[model samples]
Target: MRRDHPMPCPDRHDALAELALGTLAGQERSDVLAHVARCHACALELSELSRITDDLLQLAPAASPPVGFELRVVERVLACSTSAPTGRPRRRKRHRLASWRPAAVAALLAAVVGTGAGLLAASTTAGKAPPAASRPVTLSASLARHGRVFGHVRVSSGRTPWLFVTVDDLTGPGSRTVICEVTLVDGTTAKLGRFRLSQGYGSWGVPLAAPADSLRRALLVGTDGSVLASARI
Candidate 1:
């Protein structure tokens, strides 16, 4: 049915599938989101694809392959090679299906550990600085939708107050780099820094000027000027 909407491109379909399967990376995922947000047809397609994926996940894998199925497959291949006029064709499967399971597992583990580490790091800093004594500051923030976290904010025990930012969850690898600015309550904005976040959570420390009164309402702003979060300490 030719509605008023434009059909999504084939590439978008493939991108959507890869993203749904947690395979797309780098520019690919970005391209998918950009397209999906603008195209109603693609958005609908993505919805259906997500539902199909959920259904597939609910379905259990066959307990076992049919008896002798592997043998039969090997035999068929041998028969084809033997029946060929020329010697067994040397053509190789040009592309292979990559398994992201191992990498994903590693990432999941890192996220678990990172979350704990982040909490630990935040805790260790507690009471260490006088400014932090008033209220505990939390460094929690959301990665802008379609955005990536790259670097760590530097926080060291010294006269300066520092806040560290970490990338806990992201859509792609650690390649995505984002520039962020930190704002103090006094209306002073500092371009803290830029960093790349690969797969799991990443940490960075940002040095702050003295006079911790402004730390209460401190905020982390992304490149797009979105307030990721406020410091709890």
Candidate 2:
């Protein structure tokens, strides 16, 4: 009866996530831990995944379900189910879900497009920089006179050059949009990227147009081209 005891199966990688969530019980939990002990890669992956699970739990607090939430869910489920006419089971998405699919897809597409467009910069002097697939160089930025924005930049020598930059800040508005411009050693500026801030003030990464080590400093510019924030690297 104990799911924490080792199961007969030796390979149950699919259950690792559940194990990390503390939801795998009895033999299932025992098997996963046993496997993790012998497999370094799986153990490492389980540790990494647990961090994300912890982060998400912090972001989304536990709350009571909405009124009639269970009833609505049941109605939706029942409306989509039908008796198997020939004793064959059928699993298909119902038409009721169609109304929201297009809108959701469109919203996702628009965000991606907007993010890409905002990161585009003028032609680079570093010979298109790099594709940002390699190890990164650390950089820093400041918000004019506000505070510091620590960053990391990664650029690889590829045809389409770009910088993958991650920023850090402890104090700022949680939700806002701003442009990043990196001033290069040659006194020319590169479009580092634009970012829409969210609940987290730091640890935001975006693509830019310059190489990792080429910038003298980075500026977070406002709509009117005023430097509101900054980082130096």
Candidate 3:
């Protein structure tokens, strides 16, 4: 039998967040990986946070000014100077300066508009949900064989549901293709996907159509039709 680890401690959760953000490295990274392997709640949290991180990256990529923007500003300033009035030297100088003034003002306004637009977009996205609701509910279960724990199954719930499986400490083969199947409440089994394990260690995740709570159990099967491990949800 395997002991159930409690939900993430503050330090653990902070580590998980850093891991998801791709900022954790060195000994700290290795420690978090080892801990997540055995901690169900922390693993689920990491998975959810990872998905949120991915979405954020996709939604807000790096921003830059439009192409040739600087060149266009220079052209406008040059055009204003070239078209300056030439009747009187002093008056021409004043007119040239006045012409440059409009160009500078236009350039400033363009910059202000670009910055305001970016701010508005960020605010709109942030307004969609409260900070507390950013992390969705994720569920987990232990996979075992003959009363000995071997792996874990995690399900994330939100607009996009996901099924994540991790296997460690399995014996018998160096490499094998494992099939992930889920049993619904009505006794129906659905094969989510398959992944290869290297020396009894690997992790895989796939988007799921059914909600997380609808699953009754998760199973890991070998290509040879042998039941490797099973987890009750």
User: Model 1 TM-score?
Assistant: 0.30
Candidate 1 lDDT (Cα, whole model)? 0.46
What's each prediction's clash count? 24, 19, 0
**Cα TM-score per model:** 0.30, 0.35, 0.42
Ten residues in a row with the worst lDDT in model 3? 88-97
- The digit string of per-residue lDDT tens for model 3 on 151-193 reads 7776665544556566776766687788877776766676665
Question: lDDT for model 2, on a 0 to 1 scale?
Answer: 0.49
What lDDT does each candidate get?
0.46, 0.49, 0.63
Cα RMSD of all models vs. native, in order, equals 24.4, 21.1, 32.7
Model 2 ranges off by over 4 Å = 1-121, 126-174, 199-203
Q: Which stretches of candidate 3 lie above 4 Å from their native place?
A: 1-135
* lDDT of model 2, residue 168: 42
Per-residue lDDT of model 1, residues 1-233, tens digit only: 64566666776778888777667899878978888898888987777677888888779776774222332233334434544547664321111112112232222223222232333233233333354433323233333333454322323222333444544554355445544454444444555455444454344443444333443343445456666544433
Residue-level lDDT for 39 in candidate 1: 83
